[model samples]
Target: MTDPMQDPGFLQDPYPTYAAMRSRCPVQPVSTGSGGHISYLVTGYAEARQALGDARLSKDTAAFFAGKESRRRLHPAVAHTMLATDPPQHTRLRKLVTKAFTTGAVAELRPFITQVTDELLDQWPVGEPFDLVARLAVPLPVIVICELLGVPEGDRPDVRRWSAELFAAGKPDVIDTASHSLADYMTGLITAKRLDPGGSLLDRLIAARDGDDHLSEEELVSLAVLLLVAGHETTTNFLGNAALALLQRPAELDHLRKNPDEVPAALDELLRFDSPVSTATFRFTTEAVTLGDTDIPAGVPVLVALGAANRDPERFPSPDLLDVDRDAAAHLSFGHGIHRCVGAPLAKAEAEISLRAVLARFPGIRLATPPDRLDWRRTRLVRGLASLPVLT
Candidate 1:
């Protein structure tokens, strides 16, 4: 069968395809669009959980891309970031920045998040249709991340633009250009922090590099770039997806509106219903491993379908239905194992705060157009909408 992934309808709503794939077998091989490389896609809940934390599965990209053409297309800084490396290298890099991104550290930003939410809400046009994605979802995170990194306010729009371009999967050249541009911008920012440090996270990272030699210049640049890009990009999509899910299910939206305390639970259910990240980043096997009943050879690439795993019938009953009261905290939307997202707490806080504020301010909000007509982003990695027009 032709890969359903190549179809536009599938990209817009892949749950049906994932359901069929999961029913056939938990693990199956599929060809990656790039280089015709075969990668095992693990869709079952149990298999995905095991594969995520499996030490034999390597995050090293070099092992998967040995050809000159493959090597030429990727930037070393991007290929060397914490996400692309295994411990103890990944351990060291993660530790250097983990302190600043801890749950406690991120929780400290609640006031700031609320403030940003309030300010953005105040700008919405009264009784008119507007794009929530462009106005709220995108800027909220971009502003928060930039402020955390000590990036000046004026430069945030560029950061958001570059981040979006990096996710333009249909255009490899555009992705490459965005990657190089973002890397260069971070390189310059790191250099500036080194000369005159502030109290921000970037300053602390510079201290680690200059003080203990814990981080090299290349690693510094790469880490900053990763934080900046992933920091905003993930939460942006999360907010958009969460809002879209709620608006489509007015009953669930009303339930949350009535029981405001259940906002956190709603976030979890929404996350499982429509994960912002469809699949965890690439994982290559270091040695031959058996996942479920399938034997995957060493050096082969593996992709854990987080979105699919969350919907696995064995894990959650009536997986297609959104039950706000259901305990969906175990969902792998933020991923699992040592590579789990460090900024998850912040993302959750942002979503909860933003959603509550939007609901409170716009009680009559509804989809301006039919749900099926909404344009979803045509990307495999990040599943989200191109725009979310709503009547406020």
Candidate 2:
């Protein structure tokens, strides 16, 4: 009955609101300030998974915006990426990049990830306070992604700036400027790769474009930008949020420290408890569909509340408690069905390595400030902390 968005407790901790929604209305209607109305917020575990995998719920924004005034507002490149596609096109694009994210690829990068983590940790000043979010969380992922993509190390700072701007581009003015700037930058990179192909993902994509004719230049640039942004930003939030959660809940941190084997399981629980990406990317209905008791008509814009679904009491016992050993994989943190995240393995590895390394190295790590004093990101899409000052 309560508006989850306007609830203060929901803003701080949404588990209560999630439980209420799951019981009262699995599919409830809500409005967006843009004058569009979303017919339902799918909060239950099974239903959220079903909707994510369903073909009837389209990821293609163009289909939803077709013949609508909003069609003219979206950037063309945004609609072309794999995130906005469904079926054969999504499958095709995913195949072109799947090898880069396979378990073997991530396994090979473990040593490199460890090295990066150690190098950053080695630089941390002793005794005094330091901001973990900026010094470590932000740069580690950016550096790893740059290396993976063969992006020049010297260009990392600029790349990070561009990535942050792109993530913050939810505003109209910011979106327009950031989109144009990123497009121009990517165009130059793609051109260089075409001339001097090398061993990076971008180079592989260029080779694919030239040899197989399966990929286009525009698509290559779009994919490159997507990898750069998604690869770094989401992981940054994951590591940052997980660290903050552990600091807030010392018992869970101790449990992880004692049972090093539970790192993977703990990571899953952390994701479920406080997801990095609070909402699904975006979905538009292909045709009028019935979800629970709600009838969502075609062309309606819908965003799945992944954070809410993860804490649904009906799905997991004691969903609000942080249980490191719980079978938390059922949580929709990586989503489900066809639209499941392709970079999940890599992200999981990164989180496990990062958390383990931090706990091992800084056993005395604790929040330098009170939990409530810590700043959180204002956006609903990416749940992150502004800064996490910790004492090693």
Model number with the top TM-score: 1
As a whole number from 0 to 100, the lDDT of residue 154 in candidate 2 is 82
Residues 1-392, candidate 1: write the lDDT tens digits.
33557766787789888999989998989887755768899889999999999999998876666663652354567766789988888988888888877779988999999999999999998777899999899999999999999998888888889889887877888888888888888888888877888999888888888887568888888888899988988899999999988898889899888888889877888899899998898888989999999999998889888899999999999999988888999999998899999988889999999999988888888988888888887777888888999988
Output the worst ten-in-a-row residue range by lDDT, candidate 2. Answer: 70-79
What's the distance in Å from true for residue 247, model 1?
A: 0.5
The local lDDT score (0 to 100) that residue 165 gets in candidate 2 is 66
lDDT scores of the candidates, listed in order: 0.87, 0.80
* Model 2 lDDT per residue over 266-350, tens place: 8888899888888888887888887766778876766688988888777878878888878888888888887788888888988
Q: What C-alpha lDDT does candidate 2 achieve relative to the native structure?
A: 0.80
Quickly count the clashes in candidate 2. Answer: 0
lDDT of 2 at 369: 90
